[model samples]
Structure formats: C-alpha cells, structure tokens
Target: MLYPTLRPIRGATLLLTAGLLAACALPRVGPNKSEIFAGSVLREGDAFVLTVDDRVNAIAAVAPALGFSAGFLNAGELGADTIRAGDTLGLTIFENVDDGLLVPTGANATAIEEVQVDAQGFIFVPYAGRVRAEGNSPEALRRVITERLAEQTPDPQVAINRLAGDGATVSVQGAVTAQGVYPIERPTRSLIPMLAAAGGVAVEPDIARVTIQRGDQRAEVFYDDLFASAANDIALRDGDAIVVKSDSRTFTALGATGAQDRITFESRTISAIEALAQVGGLSSTAADPTGVFVFRNEPEEIAEQLVGQDVTGPQRVVYVLDLTRPNGMFMARDFAIRDGDTVYVTEAPFVQFNKTIAALTGSLSAANGVQDATGL
Candidate 1:
C-alpha cells in the first residue's frame, strides 16, 4: 500500500512537470518578434527586415501615380460646335425671288427641322443633293449647302443649326448617381463635368476611382485627384467608356491587433498610423509596442532603394516599427501602408512568461488534488 501511494504521487508530479514544459508552445495568433527577426536575411531568414527611419520612410512612401498619361493630358478639348455622324441638323433655305428651288412658290423661305445625318456622314436636301456633314461645323455645313443650292436658285440663303448627336458620346456607368449614355456636350465635354452630368459619383470621394477606356487606351485616377489637379480632368472622347467605382485596394490586419481582418483603403493614400487607427489600434494588454511590423512584397527597384542592394522582381520585405522610440509614432505616421500588406503586432514578452507560469500553477494544483484522493 505504501509503494502504491508513492507511485501515484510520482505519477502526479511527472504529469504536472510535463504540462509546464508544454506551456511554452501555446497557440498564438502569429510568430513572435524573435521568430520573425530570426527568419530575416540578416539572420539567415527568408525576408529583408529594415527599421523605419527618415530615409526608409521616404523610400517606402512611394505610391503608384494615379492620373492620365501624356495622351489624355495633352489631348485638346473637343469642339462643341463640331457635327458628327448620327447628329441632327436643322436647315432653313430662303430665296429673294419667287418659285425658288428649295423654297416653295410664294413661301420665300423653307424650314426643315430634324434632318438626321446618316451613318455615312451625309445629309440630303431637295436640290442640294447629298452633302458630307460629319467633322464640319454648323457654319461650315451652312456654307456648303448655300453654295450647292445657289446653282438652282440665285443667292440662296442657308442656315444650319447643330443638335445633340448619337455619335461622339460616352457611356457612363458604375457607382454614379445616374448611369446612362450621355452626349459629350459643351457642359459635359470633360471628365469632371461629365461625372457631374451623371449626378456625380455615388460613393465617397476619398475612395472613388474613375477609369476611362477609349479604344485601346485606358487610364485611371482618384476622384479627388480630378479636383486636386486640372490635368486629371482629362478630355472625353467618342465611344469612351467611363466607370466610377469604390477603390478595391485592401490590407490585412492580424496578430495582437484590436481587430483582425481585411481593411479597405479609406483614401487614395493611407499611412501606417491611419491604418492602425482604422483597425481600432493595437491591443493594449497583449501587444508589443516595439514589435509592430509591416510585411510587403517590394518591387525590385524599390527593394534596391530600401536595402541598398541589387534585387530583381518582387522581394519579400519586413518593415519594423518601434513605438517606444521618440520618433516611432511619427515614423509610423509617415510610413505608407500599401495594398495587400500585412500589419502584425507581436505579443509582449511577459505575456508568454505569464502564460507559462499560469499553466504550471494550475497543473500543480490539480496534481495536489489527485495526490490527496489517491492517498488511500
């Protein structure tokens, strides 16, 4: 009976000790600071880890330019008076003498409204025959008609007025107040005006993006950028397809954060501090203020600038942000968090120690109870 009692106590002690040993391997949201740094290139790790300094901040602050190219910026504004195919024209012909070719007898003047231009860009008049109207101004078309009718009637007077055409139009759709095909008129000749004509964008201006596709050319810009710079208010073209939509850019927040999820970019550009704030900031009790990290895939050119080494294509990069330093918060504020980035905060070192101690103490207490029960 004594041997059996001692054996039970020994068994209980072994079980408690094993439970304490296993406490170091507790489940965690992600790898800790030491594990992350150990994997960096400096420590024979897979990624390049760099501290966020002024130079690094400036280098990482680079964002993709969002605006039209030379083609869109350099394009001349469309002439509102110019007539295109499928447009409607109003024509009036007058002759001083009676029995004029175009004007009926005793009428003196003949007015024809809604004279639609055919697909071939031609408009037909009774005696004037077919006349090319596309690419011609209203005044120019009037001159062409007056000269043609003069052959049949002496000093024929012609007046031509241009109307909204089916051609030279753009299709506006997606996230606009109104989505429809709108003619490029005097008031809606450019990007911003056309958007206004569509009742403006339906989404927030900070996250709105406008993309214009004309044949083979395509360009995109932030909705706010259209007002920030005049050059972004690009000229509209015939058959142009304009789409306004909310930005699709997002980043993942994980590890000791107040919230762990994918967060959208509220603005065209979001700094690290802003991103942290968006996710409800870091966990007050569990987060290591010195272990905030941003993981990203840097382009070769940017990676070279960041690491002072020659790298090609996409490079795995980890940017360390220490909030304990005096400039740490400013560094975080200045650091740019890009799309598809992962923001992770490691746990405080004492958190693991506490977890281990708690596990050991709980197991020891359970073992003592087991020993007492088996003391028969």
Candidate 2:
C-alpha cells in the first residue's frame, strides 16, 4: 500500500524528470508481423496493397450473398409449403349408414386406413388404386380420392389427414440442443422458429455465424440478424439444412493496448474501432497515435485485383490507420475487423530517446538529495 508519509519528496527539477521517465516506459510487446501476416501477400510488387475498404466491402457483399440481408421474412411468406412423397396419410372413406361393401356393419360407415405415399408419388386405396398423392395437400388428396371413389359407390365421402409428414423438413445439425430433421408445415415459419422447433442452440452458437446450406451452395448469417432483420429471418424451404456452430471469428490485440489478449467476437460483426474499445483502447503513454495497424488475410479476389495477378487464396494485408488524423477516426469506424485479425499499436519513435534522458535526470536528482515528486 502507498502512503504520503513513506513517499519520496521530489524537487521541481526531479519531479519533471520522474514525470518524463514514466512517460518513456516500455511499450507493450505484440505478435511478430511475419507470424501474423504470413505468406506471399506482402512480397514486393507481387504483393497487393490492401486497405480497410477492401475488407469491409468483401464482407458486406459476401454476407448478403449468403442470405444475411433484409426482407427475407416477407419473401418467405409468399411461398406455400406443400406435401411431398414419403409422407404418411391417415385416410378415411365414408358412406351413408346401413351395411355396404365400403362400409361394413358396425364399421361406423367409415373405413380408416393408414397409407404412405410411394416413391412414384402414389398411394393405394381399396378401390381407388395408384392415386397420385405427392405435390398435393392432405385436403387436396382427399378430394382426389373422393372423385376416384365417386363412381364405385354412391355418396362416397373421403377424408385425408397427414399422419407423419416428413416431406417439408429441414436438417438441423451441429452444436444444437436437438439435432434432427424438423418438418416445415407452415409457410409463415422462418429460420428462428425452425431452430426453436429443433430445441434452440445447444450451447449458444456464435450469433455472427449460423450457416444454411441448400443444394451445392451455402449461406451464413449472424445469429442476431435472424431476429433483428426480417430479411435475415428467411423462410425455410423444403430441404433447407441449417447448422449452428461455435464462433470462428477472433482477433488478437497486442502492443501498447490497454489489454493484450486474443479477443473473440460474440456479435456477427464488429468494426475496427469497436474492436479497439473491446481491448480497452490504446495506451496513452506508450502508443503512437499515428501507428495503428490491422493485420489480416484478405480474400483472393481482392488480392488479385490489387496485385494484378492470379492469387489463388487468402493474402496477407496490413492496414495502417492513423488515429492522429481526424479522418482516421471515421476510417476506423468504417473499417471492419475480420476473422483472425490482429490489431497492433506501435510505440512512439521518441519514447526510447525520452527514456534515456529521463534515466540520467532521475539519477542526478537522487545524487543531489532531491526526492521523487511522484513519491515512488
């Protein structure tokens, strides 16, 4: 514990010297540049000069391309979910009372039967055989069945109810509480509701990355976007496969920052400015206001455009944002921190020089019996 009584008394000259000494304290050490931004992305003219704009644009465009934009809920409401083959149907044939071929005595004038739609999209009945059942609703199937039986029996009534319809189903797997196939019975049902039906995420998936794979292509969105934007809460179509997995996006904060740690994002997206805030911002004493760099691996397309070559894969790009400028603030705000990014703040160039002077001053003050003004 520090107390006034045990503190060092410093003369004006010594006080100034000690103040300068503290200002020149060593800046925080961070990850090596070669290790963080590894690869040919930084090789001479072959290297593409990447910037924050490139990253933001790539992500902004890619996210929406993967179905992360707005107006999805409205569009989903338009599609009607209909029956398909492999769905089980509860079929009942009814006729006027009195004993008959279709309605036997004490059979209650209703013949209840369970039938499954075949691969050829057909269902068999006692009299109406080989009826097409796929692509038609249960009610529609009942009408079709009724028309087929009308000629066989007078006043033949038919009722069809879905027993086990697994046709309109979405495959929900990976890190979800209930991983299985969930049937989509209503057109109004969207992504969130479908997740709820599958028993919500198993252990809170990374909200920024929930993937949806349809056919050969895949799309992803931030978890919050499903609820925050209607377009992101896209309606599920038949055979839409969803995956809620752990967060893969993370950035490391090093060098002259308030805290040096690998920070993982909880939200779908975070800007470079927001990322700095998460690590408690830059150190006022050690950090150079003009030296803020974001280290990242850019997409190949971006690399090829700037490099003017056929860059096949991810390229290393170091984006430097000068906080000393007024525009830098806006730039940082617009600059997005991507997955596996590293935010580094370099030390001021004069810090080492200042430290050498302060060390000499503090020594002279101590030899002359001048106590430290800061009481250290």
Candidate 3:
C-alpha cells in the first residue's frame, strides 16, 4: 500500500513542477507600444529634460487669446474678465461735486452696491434704468450710463463705475480638501487659484483623472503636467465644473520585490524607473536583471492600430528591459507610465523551488488528513 501511494505522490509532484515552470516562462503583456513610446520620449523639438528653458519655450508656443499671447504676459489673467449670467457686478455713480473742478471724494455723495447681471447682460441700475453691460468694457458701460442719464437731467453729470457684481460660479466635486461651488470672475481664471480656493487637493487626489467640463467639451488634466509643465495648467471659464476623482485602484508588485504592494503615482507621466523606486527599489535576492515586466491594460482599438505599424499595441506591449544594460536605463526613463501600470520583478529560478516546496507541504497535509479519515 505504501509503495502505491508513493508512486502516485511522485507523479503528482512532477506534474505540479512542470506546470509551475511553464507558468513561470509565460511572457507578460504590457502597455501598447505606441502609447508607451509616445509618452516615453519627448518630441524631437520638445525638451526631455524638464527645465526652465523648456517651460519658457512651452509658454511661447501657446496661442494668444483675449489680447494676450501667453500666460507669462497675461496680467489680467483672472476669472473676473469673463462675465456670465448670474454674475453680480457692482456699479457706482456719483454726482458731480464742486462743479466738476475737483476730484469727488467718497464723502461727497453717492450710492454703491452689488447688482446681479441677468442672462441677457442687463444690469438694473437704480434711477438710471436697465443697462446692457455685457460685451462692453468698464469705460464703455460708464459712457452708456452717462448717456442714459442725460434724458432725466440737463447737464446731469454721470459717473459710470463697475461695482462688484456676482461672478460666474462653478462646482468642484471629488477628492479635494473641500468640494463646492467656486465663483470665478472671468473665463481666464487660472485653475490653480480655484483649486486652492477649494482647499487644494486631498492627500491622494487622483491627479491623473482630473476632469474639467464646460458645456459639452471635457478635458483631462493630469497632475504631473499641471505641476511640472505650466502650459498644461488651463484657465477656467464660467460654468466650468472640475471633478478630482480619488484613485481606488492600486498596482501590486510581487515575487522578491522590495515592496509587494505599492500605490501608483497619480500623475500619468511617471516613468518606469520612477515607479520602481517608489516601491523601495528592486529586491536583490529575487530581482532578475533581464526579467523586469510592466503589465498594463490595453484597449482593443489601440492594439489594432499598432498591429500593422512598427509600433506595438498602445495598451499592452510588454517591454523587456535589461537593467544590466546602460541603454536600458535611459529607455526606462523614456517609458512613460500610464494610470494603472503594474511593475513586476520576477524572482530568480531558485525562488520557484521555494514555492514548489510550500505547495508540496500543503498537498502532504491534505493527504495525511485523508489517510486519518480512512484509518489507514
């Protein structure tokens, strides 16, 4: 009876060992080659080494808008300039005191208060009646008010001034210190200030997934770009809703790695080397110099686009990087990591024996249990 049991156990052990070896030899499916390469290396003209010069050039390349060529030159780059419906504008009119000879002091006489601008850009002024202030400059609105007042008083002096009015309001929801509606003064309002106003982002805000919605257009703003490249920090407009989501998913690096479980960087631009360092670097015992694998999701459409081309799939293209090679280190820097990239460092072949032994011990335990039950 012992001989028969030993033969069967030996066969089972051999089969398990073969299965484990086959599993170990299987290749990992990584990110799409196109997407990885596109992000890994900077464009020919673009700067790979992020520096002040790169920032300056990036700013210069931005298109001019609203009489401003770039963010560096824009002084009135605030939200107040872009007026929208429901925004309150303050208007102040003063009577010509001292026969218009002297500058009228605040004490002379006047009325000042906040007034709401209607959707049609109409602001109801006291005594002066409704005035269309939208699309008009501050001076233009003042002149319009003075002209309207001429109908009521002869030689009636009018002073048109923009009083503080309601500014455009936007809602910021998700992974922020505070999530609520923020009032923006104009369309050119910088997003940084708004995020600051909302109490900044949470400790682990989903930086890669920041979404900005305005009307029908939606833009994804990654944290790394927002912080690293000033050009990517977009201006906010009225009625814009910014949502900062929290990252619930995490990447697991197992098998003789420095850290078994590590949270992925919220920024989409992190490199493969940076990711490895984040988990306390590679394990000396199990890290194979040529067996580093980065597993990531690949969309079918993006994969198909790379099939015929020189590029690999945009979603899943396993990059076999040799740490021993100096060129490979540079390539690691070029490989831009995506949102859910999993960096796995396979153990040396000897590690497989440890796993196999553990499995055999469990099998023997089960066998003993069966023998005891049968009173063998």
Candidate 4:
C-alpha cells in the first residue's frame, strides 16, 4: 500500500536524505557573499590590514587591543609601602651577653618569637611595650625597637622581619592549580613566583590573562606577556588580587579548510598567516586560494579610515586575502586577525558545480520514481 511505501522512508537514512534535500533547496554561500554579512563591505585595501607596526603602536597606548596593561594603567600616586593591620612579624631582640632585666641581668636571656599585629597594628615587646608595627618596614621597626631599648639596657640590638604566612598576603583566584590567599613569605619580585606557589595557571600560561586588582585599580594582561616583559611583571602589593582568566578572545574558521571550528588566540596577538597555519591550512583540493576572507563587525569610525566607501552599521568589515598571488603572502604577514574574527575559505567553483549537479540529478531521479508509482 501507499502507507507501506512511505514507511520504508522513515528510518535514519531517510531522515538524512530529507535533511540534505532541505539544505540543497536553500541558496548556498558563494565566494563573494555570506548570509551573515551585511552593509557595504570594503575589500582588502579599503579595510585595514593591521601590520606589525600598527600593533606595536596600539600596544603603547593607554589600553591595548587584546587587553590592558596593569602597570601602565596605574595612576594612583605612590602609596606608602608597608605592612597592614592583621600582618605578622618575627622579632629577635639580641643581647650579646645574654643577661638582662627579667633574666636576672645574667641568667641566660634570649627570646625569638613571632607575634601577630593586633587589629590596631600594635606588637608587644619586653622593653618597648605595645608599639605600632603596621605601616612600617622591618628595618624601620628595628630602629624604633633599638631606640626604645637604649633607655633601659646597654648595647642593645633589635631586628624585625615580616612573617610571610600570616603577613604580606596577596589573593590569587581563578584558573589556577591552587587558588587561595597566599602570603608573600619570600621576596617576590613579580607574579611568576606567586603563580608557581599556587601551582601556576590551570591552563597553559599562554592561554590565560592575568588580571591584577590593586586597591581600586584593575587591569588585565596576558600571562605569557607578563613574564616576557620585565615591566609587565610588577611586584604584587598587599591586598592585591590576581585572577587567571581563560582566553576569551576567539575567531571562527569555516568552509574548505583543514579544520573548521572556533579558535581562541593562545597569545596576546596573531596574524592572519599564523591563524591559517593553526587551522591546518586550507583544503588543498576544494579551497579557492583567492577567496580567503576575514570577517569583522568594525566600529563606525572605520568608514572614515577607508577611502571611497559607503560603510554603514557594524555588520560588515571583510578583509580578502588572495593567496594565489606572490605579493599576497607578504600582505598576509601584516594582516592581524582580531578577536571574534571569522576566517572563511570558499569552496572551489568546480567542486560547487559538481555538488549542484549531483544534488539535482538525485532529486530528478526521486521525482520520476514517485511519478511512476503514482501512475501520473
């Protein structure tokens, strides 16, 4: 019966065939245009290519393209560099002869102890009584302690050292092997040591951004860049917070390419050439070398930057790269692929034509069979 004939077309293969037929009915994207693209898109020259020099210039600005630099953006005047309340201190008050006051002036007198600075930031001492240890360097505390002892004892000496575990702490959070508020126990010049202590970033350091929040100031920089540039690796301050955010910036690759997927930039920046290599290069047989384009929704001001263009909205900003030409390779070297870019490679015209013929022939054969069965 008619119902039995239709029943044979209700399985997985039939469903797949139906899906393909539906797809074939819609207009496929060509080399020049895309369904998602809009407005009057300028070609390679009209749109900016973004050379290495351009990136260098952009990096020097107040805010860079990929992210912001913490040290460069810090505008607060230099604050007092000292310990805060709740910090700890290790004190050593030495007496060469080991004889003094409570020790009976010769009963072997020596004390080495660690004390927590009270909420008020005061630490108790034998002769100095409760003295302020907060907001003072170890050296500064030593001078104050020595001065306090001079009045009561002869040849008095004092040395103060800030304890790391309970004092001088920095908060490390986000994508890290270990995340917690860790103390700057040892001398920490940059974020590397602190990151190491916390078991480093959860992902590859190259694929993360380290955001440092000091006081009210907040800025972010790529973790790899932070280590590469000495200036970027500024010392961590007390109460400073650091987060290792996964690289959020990404670009898409589609069409006749070795791989088609959303690709996140591993480093601070990457050029179009590098991006192509990352995606396993274009599909050698089916890809049209002349149809490689990078799509972006550019800012309104970009229209002015390009000459002879009727640009409108943020819908269209396409950069075409012709790999077939000799100089095209050179131009590609300077073309920087920004975050959220769509790198598309159109299928070869011959391949598209072959696909169209195949789809049409299959559709005709199915229609004839249906007509024959219906006796029309």
Order of quality (lDDT) = 1, 2, 4, 3
Relative to the true structure, how large is the alpha-carbon lDDT of every model? Answer: 0.87, 0.69, 0.57, 0.68
By summed lDDT, the worst window of 10 consecutive residues in model 3 runs over: 45-54
Q: How well does each candidate superpose onto the true structure, as a TM-score?
A: 0.86, 0.64, 0.52, 0.64
Question: What's the lDDT of the predicted structure labeled candidate 4?
Answer: 0.68
In terms of TM-score, which candidate is stronger, 1 or 2?
1
Sequence-dependent TM-score of model 4:
0.64
lDDT of 4 by residue, 1-376 (tens): 6565655442444455556766765344444333323323233233443222343223312223444455543433222236668766777666656567434565444565668888998888877788888767677778888888888877677767766535567889999999998766554535778888898889877678888887777788778776566566566677789899898888999878888989988766687788888899988877888778877666655533542345565434566677778777766666777777899888777776776667756766786577568764
RMSD of each: 3.0, 9.9, 10.7, 8.5
Off by over 4 Å in 4: 1-38, 41-83, 87-116, 123-130, 145-165, 173-180, 196-208, 266-269, 283-286, 299-303, 307-315, 349-352, 370-376
User: Which lDDT tens digits does candidate 2 get at residues 288-310?
Assistant: 76778876666887656545678
Which one wins by TM-score: 2 or 4? 4
TM-score ranking, best first: 1, 4, 2, 3
* Cα lDDT of model 1 by residue, 1-376, tens digit: 5575466565568665766677557767789999999989888877999999999999988877878889999987776766788899889888989777767777989899999998999999988899998877788889999888888779989988765565478999999989999877788889999999999999999999999998999999888889988878888887899999999999999988889999998887898889989998989989999999999999889999999988778899999999999999999999999989999999999888887777777777777777678773
Q: Per-residue lDDT for 332 in model 3? A: 63
In terms of lDDT, the best-performing candidate is 1
Alpha-carbon shift of residue 289 in model 1 (angstroms): 1.2
Query: Model 3, range 1-376, lDDT digits (tens) per residue?
Result: 6655554554465566557655664332232223344543343321121211223223322221112124322324443554555556655554544433222554444554566678898887665688886655556667777677666544445444445544556788887888988766543267777888888778554343467776876666454446656655666655778887754445656544677776755453466677787787777765665566665544544334333334343444444555667566766666655556567666665555665666657666666676567665
1 or 4, greater by TM-score: 1
Question: Positional deviation of 247 in candidate 2, in angstroms?
Answer: 4.8
